[model samples]
Target: MEVLEAIWGLLAVALLAFGLYCCYVKYVHLKYDYIPGAPRASFFFGHLPYFWRKLKNKEVAHDLFIQWAEEHGPILRINYLHKISVVILSPEGVKEYLMLPQYPKDPDIYSMFFNIFGVRFFGNGLISDPNHERWRKQRRIMDPAFSRTYLSGLMGIFNEKAEELMKVLEEKADGETEVDVMSLLRRVTLDIIAKVAFGLELNTLHDYQTPFPRAVDLIAEGMTKIRIPFFQYIPWNRKKVKEIQDSLRLLRRTGEECFERRRKAMLNDEETPLDILTQILKSEAQEGGCDYDSMLDNFVTFFFAGHETTANLLSFTIMELGRQPEIVAKLQAEVDEFVGVRRDINYEDLGSLQYLSQVLKESLRLYPPAPGTVRWTGTENVIEGVKIPANTALNFNTYVMGRMERFFKDPLIFNPDRFGKDQPKPYYCYFPFALGPRSCIGQIFAQMEAKVIMAKLLQRFEFQLVPPQRFKVLESGTLRPFDPVVCRLNLRNPLGF
Candidate 1:
């Protein structure tokens, strides 16, 4: 113990000396790109404490980013977790930086996830693979599956899952029952992703001992395990890596069945398309669409980015509804009024839920599924009059952007009215969907799914937050509700909506 303490003491001294040297170099020799308000150097510890404190409370990170922005102006440099990560605050800067191909997805983001998943990208869709050309090609084919018209067809899948969710709630809500709404959302989402994306009927909502459903959870949890610096580098992380791979291998086995099932269905030229698997199979049927190996990668990406993100958003939105009764009532009214006219909402109906859409917009503003988008500059560039040195990492945190006072008056308030026709936030100020060349291709698909799921939920039961239950958001790969958003689902008098 004495020797260990001695080592730690020595390490601390080394860190302190290194920090001081960086300050001296920046202050005396190098005129650092000074953003006015960034944390000035401390001899013992640079910007480390502030970064650590900010990340401890996930909600605070964006606010700190805003604070740094306010102090240093727009483009500012701050060292975080021993790395010099720059926070670019302005929308113009985001556009400029994200537009340039010189900035690519950081190796760390993929590496951490790859370590967790126990697999490498075999040329996937837009998200996982490094090859831009292959990604672009696959994106074009996969794009149609998430198009406006395509989402309309998929509404039934969401509605079905929502209905299944309600059934689970009803089954469990007998007496003083506390429901893990987030868990159910995960199940429904898993089922929906399986049915829609893989053409497999997981029915995780119904089944407990399913390989695919368990695999999904393992992947999510395993992915989180890899985020730690210890897991990223240490020898013990190898065991964790194997567990993650086992989870992914199970998923891949499921995906293989999906691949073969869809191919057979396609060969028969059946009149009915199964789901996203059908779309992928159809795309692959054409020459130069997606090769077999790449299709598997897309299957994985679709499961994670499409199913997982939407599920987390649904969970977050539901929790928000439980907390904010007023928003829930207003959204429920819109659902009732819309259903009164349309009977069953069609594609046009999905487009017309303006208030419901706005409410979701507000929810996402607070709890973005993907909190911070990061890019590493492959070349030197300037953002908001500040020159970013090549090889410097750029982090544009959506969680932070949504909270800046300059972006929205009373930034923390939950007000959907901000997005109303009378008051549209400037494009840069609001990019929950992101912007530029590599913007989310599935934005429309996500929005449509959110509106349908939330609208459906609000229609039947009034979801109330269980007293003081609240989530401290965590930006683990994607933004996630910490765990256990307990809620009370009380069924109201039968109302047609």
Candidate 2:
């Protein structure tokens, strides 16, 4: 009885200590109350309760950010558990935070990106690495792979993969069959990236049951699901977590196999395709070399980032064109003018489709993949009279800025003419690919691929948006269609001119 009493006393003391720690964390979070934000749903939980409720309803974090931006103005603060998250909605604030090298990516947030469910997803890769110098070194070494010359040489592969998609869509273009174009486009993009980046023939466009594509889908789903607190402990979530883990293992294994194959090919002095994998391997060979894990990190990063963003971009653009018929007619005319009867799209054809560029730009404005990024403020600073505390996590989101009426007139409308060659570009506000030194390195590569696929689609089909489909955007790691872009497509004019 005496021993039991002693044990109870110790347990009570431990609980008290934990409770006090929670109180202290709340105190620090509440100190930023003067920075203007929504009423806290709970003193202990801060905004997490509210955030959880929204998340449960499939609403993304950005929806609340926009609401707070409206209520509290451009630069506002909110308590996210023990952390003070300051959202920058103004163009100036975004420019200040993103353009400068002094502000590094927030370790707390980006560290989450380095792993998914304890598996190294993008571990220490260029996308997830917060170290300035190391990232710079990696970026510099990988730059040549995405150079205009190298990308220009890959036009044949892009055309081949995109045409594969066209053939699939053609079979479904019966004017009555509703097809999920987003899924089809995703498969094609996956094939393109696999071929171009790793010299692998995924053939996902023709075959969807492939393990690699399935693994990729699960990993993407897991990245979002893992963000939920106590997800692993929940009964329903355990299965999902396990699937994600299995998928990660599969991805790592495949990457290792590919790496070994490429390495041996090099060792044997056999000819190898000058692809992104070759460049990454060459980078490893030079400058003291990179480890297998880091190389795998790059493999996953390049594979996903290479394909996913551009696929969504094209998906959203196609959806927008279906909604706006006049724009479709106009874009189709341009495609017919520049790329008439041409089965293969050349690099010059990509540039000549100028209006298509504007359409793509506008689509990205509405639906930017990887919409926002967070930075850890190294020093205390004032932005437009508000005092920003040091060590705060600052968020810059194009999704919020793109919808701001101040940035673009009629911000809600999908108007391609806003990016007309004669029109003056919006300053610092429209960063679908982000801005500054940390901007997406694959911007040119992605756009080139998008132009080729889009030009072919325009020349071939007239897409009609199917009813009962919500065109809403779902904020995954990237902004994707809540419902995949479902459409009934018909061969344009039916008669070759």
Candidate 3:
């Protein structure tokens, strides 16, 4: 009789706790009732069920956000439980939030990236570092590596790596063999970044079995998987979680080895190239402390930031060119005129390819690899005449804005003429690299490398997309083609260059 009484008493306490938690959730929901958002699917989950359903349908997540913006108007709110995100789709909102003030990145989102599955990932790296003063200090120290003079000196390295890709393409340009151009582009960009930034020879293009590239793909997959709440806790996710952890370990181990070699070189008074690695070492020396973990954070950061987005950019450009022969013809004409019979494309040549620039800009508008940036606001503000409460996450996406009818005419159409010489540039509506104080430092570097690879491809090959292809976008941490973008390549008739 006594044991039964005790069991009943414990059950009563559990029920009371559950009741209080539900009441708290209800209270929070009522607090944000003024913000326009979809009705909560459940008293506890708060829109997660609807989001999960969309994910199950294989729709890109951001596309759903765009749909919501169109339906609910520009300044709409989305909630994942207590976390409320105010997605700003209007140019005015974007200018006010992202450009005018230097709002700190949302800690809820960025802090999650500091570690993945209990392993340190991007802790204090330039990309994930939330502290403004430290980031500014690091940025100032690292700026010289991306200066115009330094980049001009990198043209030879860019040309050398691009030429290596052309040789690889030449072997496969039989016009009958189907080539996964996206994969090849990823490899080339990987090689370029490794060689140029770290002074390492990661010839991934020649060797498909390299562990480094696989590790990168796994880390990217991990980044995407980590976003799903409690993903690592599920029983079925054990193997996937283990794979992600292993990849993180491998990448960090490689970074450590590279850093050690450079450190020893510096200690021994050996000659070192003024590459990004050297700059990082110099920064550490000036600080008078050796934070190897922080150094490795940047090493991992650049390995991803320096290469993945650019590779995706080139892949999307090629995919569009394959579908539209007119665009390809124009690109070929521009390349032929500027780079006629020239094997080496110099820095001066990149500026003259105006039409090519427009094509790339159009591609970015349609498919920016890193589509959005998030900022957190600590004070209440009004945007688009809507009252946004304090402590809200302000979300800005170029992808949704680039496609919105309010921002661009015929937004769904892929037309480079929107960026033609006589056209008026979109005002605050197009920022693929973001804007204001914290815009991408490597913007010019990325575009320069892209122009070199693309100009060469236009000079040498005519590519056709494989039939029945699905031109869908995938958001795996960054945006990329859902398909591998397979194509058939043939050498240009008469070999114009």
* Top TM-score prediction, candidate number: 2
Residue 353 C-alpha lDDT in model 2: 92
RMSD in angstroms, candidate 2? Answer: 1.9
What is the lDDT, from 0 to 100, of the residue 429 in candidate 3? Answer: 86
Task: For each candidate, give its TM-score against the true structure.
Answer: 0.85, 0.95, 0.94
**Candidate 1 C-alpha lDDT tens digits along 270-331:** 56554766765566556465666767766776776777788788888877766677887888
Off by over 4 Å in 1: 1-37, 40-63, 80-83, 99-103, 115-118, 121-124, 173-175, 232-240, 268-272, 341-344, 495-497
If ranked by TM-score, best first, what sequence of candidates would result? 2, 3, 1
Judged by lDDT, which candidate is best? Answer: 3
lDDT of each: 0.69, 0.84, 0.85
Model 2 lDDT-worst window of ten: 283-292
lDDT, residue 149, model 2: 86
lDDT of 2: 0.84
Candidate 2 ranges with C-alpha deviation above 4 Å: 235-237, 493-497
Better of 2 and 3 by lDDT: 3
In the range 69-114, model 3's lDDT, one tens digit per residue, is 7778888777666566888887887787777546877887889889
Per-candidate clashes, comma-separated: 4, 0, 0
Ranking by lDDT: 3, 2, 1
